[model samples]
Target chain A: MANPAYVAVDWGTSSFRLWLIGKDDSILGESRSNEGMTTAAKTGFAEVLASHLAKVNAPENLPVIICGMAGAKQGWIEAGYIDVPASLSSILAGAVAVPGQRRDVRILPGLAQRDQARPDVMRGEETQLLGALGPGSTGSQAVCMPGTHSKWVHVADGRVTAFSSFMTGELFDAISKHTILSHAVAGADQSPADEAAFESAIKAAYEQPAMATNLFFTARSGQLLHGLTAAAAQAKISGTLIGLEIAGAMTNAGSGVSITLVAAGRLQGLYEAAFKALSLSHNTIDADTAVRGGLAAAAKAIWPN
Target chain B: MANPAYVAVDWGTSSFRLWLIGKDDSILGESRSNEGMTTAAKTGFAEVLASHLAKVNAPENLPVIICGMAGAKQGWIEAGYIDVPASLSSILAGAVAVPGQRRDVRILPGLAQRDQARPDVMRGEETQLLGALGPGSTGSQAVCMPGTHSKWVHVADGRVTAFSSFMTGELFDAISKHTILSHAVAGADQSPADEAAFESAIKAAYEQPAMATNLFFTARSGQLLHGLTAAAAQAKISGTLIGLEIAGAMTNAGSGVSITLVAAGRLQGLYEAAFKALSLSHNTIDADTAVRGGLAAAAKAIWPN
Candidate 1:
C-alpha cells in the first residue's frame, strides 16, 4: 500500500465523508457517517473528526483539508466566504486553518454572490464546481448541482460570473410531505416509475412556468378526476419542480452556454430525464468524483511536497 | 332579536362560521369557532354543528344551509360536485341533504373542473362565486379568492367557464415553518410590515414567475447579505406566491377580463397590494359577505316563505 499523504473531508449539514489519499494520488482509505456539522457542533467537532480518522486508520501526523458546512459560522470554525466574481483557484487560497490542533486542519471558504438583487451563497458545491471544471476551464458553462438546494452557476472563462440557488429538492419534500399534495403522493415509493407522467409534467411546467403552484395542484386533481396513480402524482411534482428550475436557470444562463450537470444516483437520473424531456442537451459529471477531486486539489495546494 | 328562519354555515378545513338568518333576510345571531372539518371529523361533525347552532339560537324547524369542506367526502357527508363548465344556478339545485338530520339540513355541492388535462375540485368557493356574480350577471370576469388553497375562477355570461387552485397560502405556511427559510422569517408576525419589500417581490415574481423557488431563497440570502428584517422576509414570500398566482390566473382568464377580488382581512390587503403593484384594475368584495350571500341564496332557493 502507498504511504498516506493527507486527509480530505466533506462535512455537510447532516453528512460527513473522509478520504485518506496516498502520495501517489490514489485513495488509500475512506470513512463516511451522519456526523455532519449539525451533529459535530453538539458532539464536538474534534472528537467526531478523531473517531472518523481512527476508523480510516489515518496517520496521527497527517494534515486534513475540509470543505462544506464545517467552515460555516455554525460549524466547527467560521471559514467565511470568497465573494464573486472569483477564480476557481482563489478557493485554495481562502482555506482557514483550525487553531491549536495537533496537526494542521484547513476548511475551504464558500462562494458568495453579494449582489443586492440576487444575493446567493454556496458551500460544498463550490468545491464540486472546482473539481468538475478545474481552476482554468476555458468556456461559458451553466453548471447545475442538484440537491436539497439546487444551484445553477454561470461560469465564464474560469470565473464564476453569476449563480442562483433554487429550493427544488427542499420544496419537493415540503410540498409532498407537508402540503395537501401529501395525500396525492402517498405510497409512491413502492409503485412503478411514471415516466410518461413525468415527461408530460416537465413539458407543461417548462412551457408555462408561472403555473407552478397550479401544476402542483394537478397531482390531487388528476387523481380525483383521472384516477392518476400515486407514482404518477409524485412524478408530476418532481417534474414540475425540475422543469421550473431549468426554465429559471436557462433565463439566467443566456442562449449559448453549454450545460454541465453534477449529480449522483437518483438526483442525476431525475435531472437527466428532465433535460431530455425538455429537449435540452447536457453533459454529466459524477458528484462524488468531483467533490473528492476538489478536496484533493485543496490538500495539494496547502501541502506541496 | 327577530325570529330565526334558517342557519347558514361556512365550514372549512380549519375554521367554522355560522349565522342565523331571519325571514326578512336579516342576521339574528352569529357564532365562530376553530372546530372546522378536520377537528369536527375527529370530534363528531354532528355534535359540532349542534353546538354552533345552539349558540346562534337556531330553532328546531329552521333548515340549515352549508358550504365548504363540511360537504367533502371526509366531512359530515359527501355532497359531491357539479362538473364545470356549469351554470351558477346549478349549484343551488345540487345541495345534498343529511339523510338522518332532525332539522332540514343540506350541504351545497362543490364545483369540479373535470378537464382531463387540468382536473380540479372546489368545495366552498363556488358559493362565493355565486354570491359575488349572482345567477343573472354578465360579461367576462376573473374572480380571485385567496386562501390556503386560492381559487381563480373565470366566469362569462353568468356561467363558470374555467377555474384553477393555487397552493399559495399553504405553501407559504409550509415553506415558512418547514424549510430553511423558516429561520429567515422567525418573529415576522410581531415585526413591522415591509411594504416595499412586498411590492418589489410582487413585481419581480409577476415579471418572471419561473424564478419563484430562487426568489424564496432570497429570504435567507438577503438576510445574510443585506441584514433584511424577518418581516421583509415574510413579505417577500407572500408577494412572490401571490404574484405567481396572479400571473397564472391571468393566463387562464385571458386579457381584458375584469378582475374581482373576493377576500377578507390580511389576504385581501396583500392581493390588493399585488394588483396595485402590477397596475391591474380590480374591485374588492368582502369574502365574509360573499359567502353569506351565497348561503342565503341557497337557503332562499331551498325554502321559500
Candidate 2:
C-alpha cells in the first residue's frame, strides 16, 4: 500500500472528528477530539491539530479531506457554501487547497439554497449526503439529520435541491425547563416515547382542540391544584414539542414521499420514531459510514493515481 | 370608642401586610414585610407577626384579623377555605384565635371549589374582593390583579361571586426566553407591546386553524430567512400568548360582558393595549387605591360597635 497517505476530518460548529486511511481504503489510524470549530479559534487550530497527529502516531504530511463547519466563515479556514444546480466538483465553493502546508488539504463545500422561497442554507451535511448516495447514488431523496438544529435536506440528480432547519432540541429544553411545565416535571433524563405517559401526551397534543399556549398552563395548574405528576407533565411537554417538530419537518420534506433518515446513535432512533409517529416511510442512512464513504469517494477523485 | 377593635392582615403567598385600627375605624399604626405564607414555615406565623409589630409603633392592645394565604393549610395557622355559595360574612368559616394573645387574632378563611366540577381553589385575595365590595364601594365590579399568579375577581352584592386565575406573565416569560423565538430576540426589557406585531400575532393566533404550537416556530424561521426583527418576534410571542390567555380566561368569564381593566402602571397599559388591539371593551380600574380600599373595608367591618 502506497504510504498510507490521506485523512478525513468532519469538523462542525460544536464538534471535531478526524479519520485517517491509506491508498487501499484500509484504516491506518483515527483521531476524534472535542476541539470543535468554535473552541479552535480561542486555542490555535494548528497547535491543537499538531498535538492530535503526535498522539495518533500519524505523520503530519498526510493529505487531509475535511467537511462540515470547519469551512465556515468563523471556522479555521472559510470554505463557503456551494450554490444550487451545481455538482460536487463545480459546486466546490468552500473547498480550498491550503498552501504552505506539508500535506495536501482539500476541504469540502457545504450546501446552500438561495431559492427566493424558503431560502434556507446548510453546511457539512451535503458531503455526507453525497457519500450516502455513493458515486452512483443519485435521484431525489430527502435526508433527515436529527439534532439541536435538525436539517432536512432534499437532494436529487447529484446535487442539493433544498433544505430547512428546525430548532427542536432547543425548544424541547426550553418548554421542559423554563416553562410552567417546569413546576410539573419532577426530573429530567426520562426517555423512550413508548411509555404510557408519553403516548398519552402525544395523543392529547395531536388530538386536543386546544392550542399549545392554551394547553401549557394546564400542565402547571393541573399539577398545582389538580394533581398532575411531574413525570407526566414532562412527557406531555416532550410529546407536544416532538409532535410539532414532526409536523414542521414533514411540511419541509413533503408528505407521502420517500425520505432517508441520515442519523446515527440515539438520534437515529429518534428520527425513526418521529417518522413512525407521523406515519412517514423513511430509509435509515448510516450517518457514521456515510461520512466515511464520502471521504473515500473524495480520496478517489482527488488522489487518483 | 371600643378598643380597636381588630387588626386586619392581608397575608398573601409572597407578602404580609397589617393594619392596627381602633373601634372607630381609625388607623393607629400599620406594618408590612415579606413573610408570605409560601416563605414562612408552618410554625413561624407568630414570629413573623411579632417581627412586623416590633418594627411598628402600636397601641397596647388591638384585635387582629388575618386573611389570604396566611390561612392556607400550609400557612402559619391553617384557617382553611369556606365552601361555595360563600358570602363575605359567611366566609368567616372559623377564625383561628392565637394562643396567649392579648386580643382576637382572627385568620380569615379562603374559598375552595376543590374536588368540585371545575376543581379550583383560592387561598388569598378573598379579603381584597370583599373589601373592594364594602359598603363604601360602588356597584358590582370586576377586579383584575395581574402578576405571576394573576387573579380576576368578580364582585357583586358585596360578595365575590366568581374568580379565575390566568397564568399569563409566567407563560409569556417562558415562551419568549426559552423557545425558538429566543434566536430572534437578543434581549428586551419589559416595554409596551409592539402594536403592529401584537395585532398581527393576535389575529394570526385567533384566526389560525391550528393552535399556538403550529404558530410559534414561524417566529424563528420567519426571522432567520424572512428577516423578522427581534422586537417583532417578542411581540409575536406576546400577542399569540395573550390571545390564548384571553381565550382561556373567556372560557371561564362568559363573553359580551363588561370588562373592567384595573390598570394603573405601564404594564397595565400594555395589557390594556393588547385588549384594545383585539377590539375588546374595558373600563380601567385604578389599582393604586384597590389595596388601600381593601384595607379600609376590612378595618370598618371589625370596628362596628
Candidate 3:
C-alpha cells in the first residue's frame, strides 16, 4: 500500500468519518463512528481523534484536515465562517489551525448568508460544494445537499450567491418519533417503502407548498379513511418534507435551472425519486466523494508537495 | 341555585373541561382537568367523567352532552363522523350515547372531509364552528380556529362547504422543544413576546408560503448571526406557522374574504397579532363561548323541552 499522505475527517453533529489518503491521492484506510461533534464534545475531541487515528494506523506525523460541526463554536475549535457572496476558493483561506496540537490539524470554515431578511448558515456543506464544483467551475447551478438540515445553494459561476437550509430531515425525525403521525408510521421502516404514496405526496406538496402542514396531517387521515399502510404513511411524511424543500429551492432559481444533487445512500435515492416524480432532470454527485474531494483540496492548498 | 339542567364537556386529546348548566341556561358550576382522551382511555373515561361531575356538584339526573376526542375511536365511545359538505346542524344527528353510563350521556360526532386526495378529520372543532357561525347563519364566511392543529373552515350559507387543518401549533411546539431552534427559544415563554419579530416572520411567510421550512431555519440562523433574542426566536416560529396557515387558508377563499377568528387567551393574542400584521380584517369570538354555544345548540336540538 502507498504510504499515507494525510488524514481527512468529516465530523458532523451526530456522525464521524475519517479517511486516510495515500500519496497518490487514493484512499488507504477508513474509520467511521457515531462519536461526532456532539459526542466528541463530551468525550474530548483530541481523544476521539487519537482513537480513530490509531484504528486507521495513520502515521504519527500526518497532518489532518477537518470539516463540518467540528469547526462550530461548540465543536473542537471555533473555525468561524466565510460569509457570501464569496468565491468558493475563499473558504480555503479561512481554515483555522487547532492550537496546542503537535500535528498540524486544521478545521475548514463554513459559509454564512448574513442578509438580515433571510439569514442562513451551513457548517460542513461548504467543503461539499467545493468538492462537487471545483473552485474555478463556471455556470449557474442549484446544488442540493440533503441531510438533517438540507441545504440548497444557488451558485452563479464559481461564487455562491445565496443558499437556504430547510429543516426537512430533522422535522421528519422529530415528527415521526414525537408527533401523532408516529402512530401512523409505526413499523414503517421494517416494511418495504410505498413509492406510489411518496410520488403522490411529492407532487401534491410541490404544487401546493402552502399546504405542507395540512399534507402532513393526511399521513394519519389517509390511514383512517383510506386504510393506508404504515409504510405509506411514513412515505407521505417524508415526501411532503422533500417536496416542500424542492419547491422552496426552486422559487428563486428561475425555470429549468440545472440541479446538481449532492447526496449519498438513502437520501440520494429519495431525492432522485422526488426529482423523477416531479419530471425534473438533475445530475447526481456522491456526497462522500464531494466531501473527500473538498478535504483533499484544502489539504493540497495547505501543504503543496 | 336553580337545579342543574344539563352538563357540557369539551373533552380533547389532552384536556378535559366540564360545565354544569342550570335550567335557566346559566353555568351553575365548572370543572377542568388534564384527564382528556389519552388519560381517560387508560384510567377509564367513565371514572374520569364521574370525578369531574363530582367536582362540579352536578344534579344526579343532569344529562351530559360531550364533544371532542372523548367521542373518538379511542375514547369513551365512538361517536363516528359527519362527512362534509355537511350542514352545521348535521352534527347533532350523529351523537352516540354511552351505553353503561348511569345518567343520560351523549358524545357528538366529528366532521370528516373524505376527499381521498386531501383526507381530513376533526373531533372537537365542528362544535366550535356550529357555535361560532350558528346553524342558521347566512352569507359566506371563513372561520380560523387556531390550536395544536388549526382548523380553517369555509362555510357558505350555514352549510359547511370545505375545510383544511394546518399543523401550526403542534409544529411550533415540536420545533421549539425538539429542534436546534430550541436553544434559540429557551426563555421565550417566560419573557414578554417580541411582537416585531413575530410580525416580520408572518409577513415573510405570507408573501412566500413555499419558503415556510426555510423561514423556520432562520430562527436558529438569526440567533447565530444576528444576536436574536429567545423571545424573538419563539415569535418567529409562531408567526411562520400562523402565516403559512393563513396563506393556505386564503388560497381557495378568493381576495378579501371576511375571517372569523375563534380562539382563547394566548392563542387569541398571537392570532390577533398575526391578522393585524397582515392588515387583514377579522372578527374575534371567545373559544369558550363558541364551544359552549355549540353544545347548547346540540342540547336544545336533541331535547326540545
Candidate 4:
C-alpha cells in the first residue's frame, strides 16, 4: 500500500481552495482558483482541481478531506450536512465517501439549524469552525464569519447547536448598486470626506434599527440640505448596512459568550467597528487560519485513538 | 404660457417613459430612454430632461406631469405621498410645485401606506394604476404591479389604503444567480419548456406554502432526475416566486374585489400563471394602454373641479 497523504479543501460559491498536508499535519502547499462551485460542473471540477494542484506542487493521489459548498448539490460531489449538537468526530465520521485517484477521499458534512427563525444552513464553514476549536472544544462561543452571507455560529460544548446567516454583503450591493439608493453611493476613490460619511452612516444604522428605511432618504437629503458629496453619502449608506448587521447579529450572542471573528482583509475592519458598536469583546482570526486550524482539529478527531 | 402644451413622465429604476398628452387627453407623441432617475442626477436633471424632450416636437415650456421613482428621495425632487382616503386630485394637489422648469413641471406625489411593516411607499406606479382605473375610477379594486419589487395594491373608494411589496422578481434572480440554489436554475430562454416548468412551480408554491426553502432543492433534483432543463428550471424558479407572491397578496381580495393586473409584455403572462395556481379570476391590462389610461386619469385630476 502507498503512504497516505492528507488534503484539505474549502470549496465555496466563488472559489476553490485546497491544502496538501503532511502526515505530521504541516501544510506542504496550498492553492486557490476562481472556478468556484457555482461556475464549475462535475467535469470542470477535475480541471479546476488539477489547475490548482499544479500551482501548489501537490500530488494527485493524496487522500482529501473536503468541506464547504463543494459537496453541495451543485458542488463537485454533494456532501450533505449533519444536525445540531454536532460533534467534530461525528461529522468527520459521517464524511460522505467519494471516489478518488488512488486515495481515500472524504467530504465533510455541513450543519443545519432547522429550529431557528429561518432554518439556517452552513456547509464547509461549520466544519472549519469545528476544526478551529479543535477536537475537544467545549463551552458556549459565538463565531462571526462575514461574507456575502455572513454567519453567526453558536458552538456549545464541542457541538454546533445553531447558526444564522445574514445576506449583508449581497443586500448592501443590491441596495447600493441596483436600487435608487445607488445614486448616492460613489465608488472606491479614496477620499477623507467619503470615510467620514461611511462612519456617520454606520452610526445611523446602529442608533435607530427600525429607522433603516428612513435613513436611506438622508443619503440624498444630506446631499441636498448639507451638501454631502456623493462619495460621503455612499459611505453613510455602507455604514447603515454594516451597523444593522452588527446590531441584528449581536442580539443573539448577548453579552455572555466570548466572540471570535473569522474574517480577512476588508471585512475585518467592518467587523471591528460592528463589535465595538455592540459593546462586545471580540478576538480576530484570519479566515484561512480558521479553516486550516479547523481542518487540523478534524484530522485529530478522525485519527484520535 | 404660449399655448400651454402638457406632458406626462413615468420614471423608474431602470427606464424613463414620457408621453406628450394634450389638455383634451390625446397622446400627441411619446418618448422613452434608458436614462432613468438614478442615472440622470449625476449629469444634472435639466440636461437629461432636455435630452428626452429633444425627441419630441414640443415647446420647452410645456406643462409636465412626472411619476414613479423620479419623485423618490434620491430622485429629481423629493415629492411626498398623499395618504389613503386621498383622491388622485388630492395627490395632484399635493404634487411638489417645483418652480419654473425648462417647462412648467408638476411631479405627481407617490402613495404612502403608513404605520405598517417597513412603512410601505409607492410612487409612479400607483398613479399608473389609478390611471388604468380611468378618470371615472371609483369603488374598490386590486391591482398587481409587477417588476423587481412587485406591489399588490388594494384601493377602496379611489384611495389606496393597503398594499404589499413582494421582492419576488429580485428573489428569483438572487436564488437563480447568487444563492446555493443557483444550480437549480438556468438562464431565461425559449417558451414551451418555460410554460411547463412555470406551471409546475406555481403549483408547488401554492401547495406547500411553508416549505419554500425545502422546495428549492427540487430544482436540482427535478433536473437531475426528471430531465428539467436549466431554462425550464429558471422559469420554475420565477414561477415559484410569483406564486408565493400571489399567495401572499391575494389573500384579502378573495371573490369580493376585482383583480386588475397592471403589467406590460412578458410579466402579464407570469401574472396569469400565478393567478392560475390560486384559481383566481383576473383582468390583464398591457403597458401602453395602462400608461395611457393612467396618464389620462392623472390629467383629469390635474384639471379636476
**TM-scores for all predictions:** 0.98, 0.70, 0.98, 0.61
- Scoring the B chain of model 3 against the true B chain gives a TM-score of 0.98
lDDT of 4 by residue, B92-135 (tens): 56677566565567777787655421245677776777667754
Q: Compared with the true structure, what per-residue lDDT tens digits does model 2 show for residues B213-247?
A: 43555566556446777777777777766665565
For residue A92, model 2's alpha carbon misses the true position, in angstroms, by: 4.9
Angstrom error of the Cα, residue A214, model 2: value is 5.4
- Model 1: per-residue Cα lDDT over B49-101, one tens digit each: 99988887678888999999999988999999999999999999999999888
Per-residue lDDT tens digits of candidate 4, residues A1-305? 22335677888878888888777667778787777887777457767776776777666665567788778777877777677767656777667777654555677778765452235567777766765676678778888888877777887878776666665676566656655446556554422245555666666656544344345555644554455577766666567667766655656666578998889878887777656655678898888888877766665556553
DockQ-based ranking? 1, 3, 2, 4
Each model's C-alpha lDDT? Answer: 0.92, 0.64, 0.92, 0.67
Stretches of candidate 3 off by over 4 Å are A190-192, B190-192
DockQ values, each candidate: 0.87, 0.19, 0.83, 0.07
Q: Clashes in model 3: which pairs?
A: none
Alpha-carbon shift of residue A121 in model 2 (angstroms): 5.7
Recovered share of real interface contacts in candidate 4: 0.00
lDDT of 2 by residue, A1-305 (tens): 44676787787777877776777777777777888887887897666666667666677667788888777666777777677756655433446775566778777777665554234555677777777776454667777776766777766766666666656566667667775466567564556433555554555444432334434545565565667667666666666555555655555556766788888976676556655665678799898788877877776688777
